[model samples]
Target: MNRKTLVLPAVIGLLAPVLAACGGSDDGGRAGGAITVGTTDSYTASKEAPAPLDPAYAYDAGSWNLLRQTLQTLMTMPRGGGEPVPEAAKECGFTDSGNERYECTLRDGLKFASGDAITATDVKYSIDRVLGIKASTGVSGLLSTVDTIETQGYKKVIFHLRTPDATFPYKLATPVAGIVHPEEYPRDKLRTGFKVDGSGPYTLRAEVKGDTIAKAVFTKNDRYTGQLTPKNNSIELRPFADADAMGAALDKGDIDLMTRTMTPAQVEKLSSATTGDVKLTATPGLEIRYLGFNTEAPVVRDKAVRQAMAQIIDRGQLASTVYGEMAEPLFSLVPANITGHSNAFFNKYGAPSADKARQILSKAGVTTPVRLTLNYTTDHYGSGTKKEFEVLKTQLDRSGLFKVEIKGTKWTDFRADGLDGKYAVYGLGWFPDFPDADNFLAPFLDEGNFLALPYVNSAIRDDLIPQSRREADRLIASDSIEEIQNIVADDVPVLPLWQGKQYVAARDDIQGVEWALDSSSNLQLWELSRGVSG
Candidate 1:
């Protein structure tokens, strides 16, 4: 997922039988009550009003969170970590040895919230629309492997891929593959306005203030024929400008539960509440925060300069001083819990050394006191960014080998500037699209990577990554991640800083706190409830 957006994950084994046995259980509770959630526009279903309520066009986590509840995909990653299970599909699997062809048959008696019959044609149309519209924010890239999509009558849909991709099913679980009403969403244009025609467990009704969505009300869709059933009859999403506002509402009981917008300070305040009114639960996340370099920038282009910068920065100090224990030091692009993660940066640079940095710079003929500007978003990344950069500047300046200038902007502008290659050095954070090691590759290494930084390592982009994607066994594919990490360490295109843990702070009455986060770190609102006191 884009640093500007948030996304999900899990491992796989047997899927078809597991889904068949589990079928969906609504045993915990009967639908009643209402859930009011508060979050920032950063987590909204659409980045802007009039952008379309279509899931095919959504690119952010807030939107995806909503989409996951309201739109049924062929499969879905269940809460807490496991395999992607059948959701809309009764069964799905690869049809050939190449892993290039896949097929799925829809669950019988399916219908959109509009009462239109759901069929294989709608599935084919939804996938075709994503690839056809090709919106800048749309997830068409998730289907890049698809050569063509064919449907057989109203039940089966088939995908013919350009090459083998074992992770294809995981992609099917993402918002990109969300199924929409065939007649409502146009084939070539995005459907506008605040309302959505969907087939998930919820039907959306929204309220707009001026040009932005002020509130969204989701009611249980009685027509939904999937495993997940709403625990509550209605869910209200209230968007705020920042975490402090959201936290205040939660404290005042204006909102029953809160999901993605809380900042560190707000989290601390709620967690340490003397009143014991709020509770906090954390999910182990695959999110990684790092500093990226625009290799085309005149000041940061040199490999030695990048290496020197890496040598002088101390992640341990940054973690304790700037982030507290909210994050832990990350020495590789891929986090430690994942396979192929190695402390390559640590092995090459050792401990922070100003003297070593200076020696390396001098050997490369870089004059004393190299100068550059450090960039970050003041709010997009949360409340600690300003201090994080301040600490970073101090660390490099104290070395006596560098002089630094710091700059900050809000998320919208910062993302635009970074994408345009305006920053020499900038901070970026990623919430993975999927949990596999391969996710760490294409976004940062492939030709014309998501960074938009002018970096195309032929050995990595052309050879290593493509070779790795062909391996169905992730363990075997992980061998390539080691080589990729070592290459990135040498190239220094981006420096891995820390990996974060997910936090959900809500009223003590809320239950299913543990299952709210799927393995990929995406919020599962369907799992949430109130008055359970769990």
Candidate 2:
């Protein structure tokens, strides 16, 4: 998942001094009208996300935010967050002691929004199509352990894995494993256009504008069979070009709630008593941002150079100056909230010191005034990014040991360029697929990592990751997870920056704001509804 961006304080003038009254009408203890939700995140049909609505191709958080509303997975995490629970399935678990075989039985009378009965055959086809298509940006890597899928009957589906994987159930809980209709979705290609056919709580009807989505309309799919029930009759998801516009819409009652990409200034303003009609809800967030190095690039390829740069970076300053209270300095690949988290970077490098960095570079026989270019996305991670990068440049340039040049590009091109090794160092963010340390470490460190960097360590990719996956109890794998962190700190392939907190700004009458986001920070639109104020 990509990190969301924030707007500057200059845009704060666009918001009304006080938000208007709630827009939806209350009915039978629930919201009777449609709740309009606004977000600044936009999507384009690029290689990163070829088809936003298709379960086989959508991978990023913005796409999955909408997909989760319509595509019901075999298993799903609970509202407040926990282990995977049955959704479309009546029950699911490992059938063998080795954790290689898994089975699931569909809930009786399960039917898609199209009124066709959901069965084991559809489930098998869905998994097969995702693996067969193998889109570069898709989440096919999550299902790499699956050797084959077999359907025993109309209700039962069995999976055989090539290796022991205790985290298989968690993978199934992700939208990547969402079941698709066999006839509607081809087995070897992505479904075209914006239409979606699934058994989830909502049915989607999107309005497309050129390469981006203008708005998406979701109606309660009464035919849906699942663990969740809709709290509102309908929902309208409005995508904005930036956070300033979205905040203005919320203040003017153009949208009932604003989520996903609120700027830091907007959030601070909403917390004041002057904005009486707006409510600011803060939740524990697992999102993290970091700088990734292209190990093959001439300037950053030297281990000493990367280590010296890591020593000079002040994560605390970045967290406080750039993000305010919204983020905290992170020392490990794993966030502090997750199990097996360790302060490996701090333990190795201590506090940021130009003296320490100079000594390391001198010992490595490297000359002073080293030059390098830093790349970041201009439009993807909010407008505060420019300021953040500017602060970073000052931090490095003031050391007098390095000369830094920074460049910003749009997200689509930045991602593509990063993949093609056109950048020496680039900024990236991660939103977990599941709430596990494995999701944090394995994606970037494993062989053929998603970042497309040439860095590799046999000890981490070959030994530690597989050992952790063999244990069903994630707690038992803490030692291996910590060791992985230690190796990363020593290698410096990716430098840890700061971890973020999830904040949602909504109208005072909006209910379920606390339960609307799962552990992974994916928005659940079905959980939102208009409520009567006390």
Candidate 3:
């Protein structure tokens, strides 16, 4: 899941005098004619602490969104959001077979917000810095295939890959590859403490007020020569306590737009109500909610028990009762509309049946009334989590072959403890870093993956995924995905639940609602504008 939207730090109190000196308006809604966006700081940081702003260190969605605007990558996800297009680079493409070598040319006369000359050396430095720092939670893993970086004169950069990875360019489109003025940013360490010098469409203004860092303000970077043009002159992103507060603020026009914090009920209310005050725009989302099994746990370690649980759960009912129509039943771990998606679980199990579950358990010599604990996060996921878990408990308990216990934790503790193997079977939701079957497969199933679950299926970990990565043709790569899902369905490492739809709510006068969410489901604030009807 994307990190909760970050709230303005307490130091924002200090920006008043500075903003006032600049003749800014009194209301936070309009800061010197800038669009004000409100969201929750829920997913902005790790469970342990507040997020850092350095593009190399920042991992949460909130920082990433802000970074994308303030830091221009070599390639960027366009407004409609399909393939990554040239941003700072004149052009980028692979120069060798198996996608082992990639090359790009820096656009001439490109300059940073600080007026520093942009060079191919800066591009190499930016990428090497990410690889060198190697933040555990950062985007460094996306470029793990990169073996070395080479530069030719002032405009050309080349990447030699240790292994073929077709998704390398897509990685460049992310904030991890955001080029920086090498002189301003240190090569050995992360440049923390809230100062940014980027070549993107926007620039971030942050200052130290007493002991705390003030809210970072984003304004148009007139120096940018990229494809993106800011619709608003400035933007102030602030965080709310919850979705209800955000909705109220939007209704009152305190905020021009709200992204990534609304509940399904809020979407329904905003869509159904004829108040004509707010508009709802839905985007295709690759978000997948699933039940992950820790293979090391005594109770769930048995493949038969996991398969039995997978066979008994009712997804259609969960979608209707818990999620309404906001979600659809997901039969495969890979979301629908993506290549290599198959209804493998649905095909294998057919339907929820206690008889089938019992037969599977009996054949595996597992005794009846198998004891299990199901875990979920109360805060981070959504308001529907409690109800959804209850439904899961009911379905499993009714099977008579299992005794289930439900446990709930706050998101921070849940995230930390889940990775530490605190829960035997826990619920997880995935928001893709990139729009590919690889994003879905790699993080969860790859060896030494972030999932932290000891689910190492040899054929999947060692063979299928690596083979799929080498195949450039998405259609051919999809065959491996089909086989991988079938293996998951048969092994039952994780139970595929439901995939969700994305919705962004804004006032009637807000334009670019259709383009607000990229194809990857990341909220694009640059696409928004006021004084125009959507």
The candidate scoring highest on TM-score is 2
The C-alpha TM-scores of every prediction are 0.88, 0.92, 0.87
Candidate models: Cα lDDT each: 0.75, 0.82, 0.76
Candidate 1 accuracy as lDDT: 0.75
lDDT (tens digit, per residue) of candidate 2 on 332-440: 9899878789999999999999999999999999988889988999877676788888888899999998899999998878877887889999998888988889999
RMSD of 2: 5.8
Q: Give one digit per residue, the lDDT tens place, for model 3 in 160-211.
A: 9987888888888888888988887788787755677888888887544532
Which 10 residues in a row give candidate 2 its minimum summed lDDT?
A: 8-17
What is the lDDT, from 0 to 100, of the residue 482 in candidate 3?
Answer: 93
Runs in model 2 deviating more than 4 A are 1-32, 47-49
Q: What C-alpha lDDT does candidate 3 achieve relative to the native structure? A: 0.76
State which candidate has the highest lDDT: 2
Q: Rank by TM-score, descending?
A: 2, 1, 3
Q: Give stretches of model 3 more than 4 Å off.
A: 1-32, 41-52, 181-197, 205-216, 532-534
Better lDDT candidate (2, 3):
2
